[model samples]
Target: MKRALLLLIFAMPASLSLAACAAAQQTQAPSLAKRPIEGRFDVAPPAIVIPPPGPLPSDLAGRLARWEADAASGQQAFAAERDATAALVAAAAGAPVASERWVVAQQAISRLTAARAPLSGALADIDRLYIERTVDEAVDGLPDIYALRDRIAEMESAQDAILQALSAALPGQ
Candidate 1:
């Protein structure tokens, strides 16, 4: 009887350890098979290939050319105003109270603000043109419009940021 009791004590731990190993194996078996099942059903779709877009119509191209010219001139005008304002501010700092240079600085700033109006208008026209073109292409079931549309949006955002910065940097708020 004592021999049997001694055998039971040692065998019980071995049997428990064996059962634990089997349970671990059963859980891990599903994970090992899961990868193959997932791979079989999770096939990726084929890549889409978009064709190149055609050139803009002559009239639209002309409009874009004119707007580009306007944008260039507007940049030149803004730079001129910025240089004049800087000079006037420097002069006003050394001059006596209530200097005329300060007034000229204000005028330069006003001119800068005025110059942005036509630029903003030209940008809007460009945006409208691109949007219309994009929509037209979409109706025809084409994907090439995205590039032009994105370009226009990027340009509009950059120009708008410049105008905002100029407005903020103007002397006296």
Candidate 2:
């Protein structure tokens, strides 16, 4: 009776361990053949398209035109002033600061800076319009506004470069 009792206790645990090991082996084994995926894996997502913007409103269009014209005129005036200043700066390159030529050169530089006002004003107006359009959710006119702004900005940069070069050319700069 004692021997049978001890054998039952030890055999019970061994039988349970064997059962667990067999279940693990079955789950870990690879399948003999690969199955096809349930759905189309190569399918592409739909493309997104955005339509081009329409014309700007009449009022905004007129304002942009006026600003563009103003920038053009300003660019012309700046070019003239830049040339004059460049010549003056060249003449005063080695002159003393208190000499007449140096004084004239300084005055020319001042006028050159003043000549950029119209272009600056146009850029400022365009910036205001852009802000207003964005705030009002008027997106249709943004492209034109941006185009004008970019053009004016380039002109302004060129003027600035000229100004820098002229200033640097002056004596005791």
Candidate 3:
């Protein structure tokens, strides 16, 4: 019984010392990294931003300057490109049916001409919008509101036809 008491007395101090050590470690626990960005194990850098389109042709500066002018300018660009393309076709050797190509070119010219007045009408709408700040207000008792609407429609249709013809003319599939 005396020997057992002595063994327990020795073991008690060692056990207490171990408990104190564990408690100290718990108190001094290291803090976690607050932000995930600090340790970016798998992250890459940000991508570049591209600007909105600018004038394509050097002379196209005037066209892009004012927003309302865009349609009229676009029409001019279409005609110019069509003429240049037609000239190329006329000059090209053994291009099947140059006469047919020229006829198509005339049709494009007619379409562009037809598109011009409507485009001008759209510009008028823009001008009205500019003056009045709202299309609702601008459209009140307007002399030719229908004509302005017609022009916007014409511009859309003409733009589509131009694209379609160009797509057809582009070099083989």
Best-fitting candidate, scored by lDDT: 2
TM-score of each: 0.51, 0.70, 0.30
lDDT tens digits by residue: candidate 3, 1-173: 99999999999999999999999988967778567777776668688886533324333223324534656665676566666555543443233544665455545545555545545555665555445524444333233333344555576677667555654553330
Which lDDT tens digits does candidate 2 get at residues 1-173?
99999999999999999999999987867776745774557678888887776678788888998999999989988888887788999999999987999999999999989988899999999999999888987888789889989999999998888888898889878
Candidate 1 residue lDDT tens string, 1-173:
99999999999999999999999887845434456556786878888987655555555556666777666676566656666655655555544444576666556656766765555666677667657766666323123234434454555566566555544444454
User: Residue 142 of candidate 3: its Cα lDDT?
Assistant: 34
Clashing pairs in 1: none
| Model 1 / residue 161 / CA error / Å | 9.1
Better of 1 and 3 by lDDT: 1
Collision pairs in model 2: none
Greater lDDT among 2 and 3 belongs to: 2
Residue 90 CA displacement from its true place in model 2, Å: 0.9
Model 3: worst 10 consecutive residues (lDDT sum):
55-64
Q: Highest TM-score, which number?
A: 2
- Native-referenced Cα lDDT, model 1: 0.61
Better of 1 and 2 by TM-score: 2
The 0-to-1 C-alpha lDDT of every candidate, in the order given, reads 0.61, 0.89, 0.54
